[model samples]
Target: MNQPDHEFPDESRTIRPHAGESIEDTRNWPGLALVAVGLVLLALTLTAAGYGFAGWAVIAGALCGVCLLGGIGIVVAEHRRVKAR
Candidate 1:
């Protein structure tokens, strides 16, 4: 009778999580918060700059733009961190 191979692969044994592993470490909460704040500020700035429905739309667009830029900045920073790791 032929016997089957019983050896497990090395990769399978190395998949355990580390004791200090944390989801928070990889998250950029502070950067995201800053982006939110910047968006609010941009909205306020646009509102202060005008009035009426058109003014509100302008303000919202400006705020969205600022938020987009801030998000891009945060994403770039995160990318750098990932590359470093």
Candidate 2:
């Protein structure tokens, strides 16, 4: 006997995208806080250190910290949004 071809897929994977309303209630406090902290630390470190290799290292670290924090916040928000759907 010949079986009819299905238009929709018979999925077994549970990681399929959600077919529901999108939850767009994202917060900015976390990323803002990180940026603020990073700026403050960079200012203090640069002011006290004056000019040297150590100062450059400190500045790099501050920038990296800010970027890492921002990335983390974004990841968390996306995770929440996906879970909500």
**Which structure among the candidates has the greatest TM-score?**
1
Give a tens-digit lDDT track for model 2, residues 9-60.
Answer: 3333455544421223345445555667666666766665665568666766
Q: Tell me how far the alpha carbon of residue 85 in candidate 1 is from the true structure, in angstroms, after superposition.
A: 3.3
Per-residue C-alpha lDDT of model 1 across residues 1-85, encoded as one tens digit per residue: 9997665433344554334332244566655776777777677666765665676667667777777687658756775665455
Model 2 CA lDDT for position 68: 59
Candidate 1: Cα lDDT at 64: 70
Q: Model 1: residues >4 Å from true position, as ranges?
A: 1-23, 34-52
Regions of candidate 2 where Cα sits further than 4 Å from its true position: 1-52
TM-score of each: 0.42, 0.41
Total backbone collisions, model 1: 0
Superposition error at 26 for model 1 (Å): 6.1
Q: What is the C-alpha lDDT of each candidate?
A: 0.62, 0.59
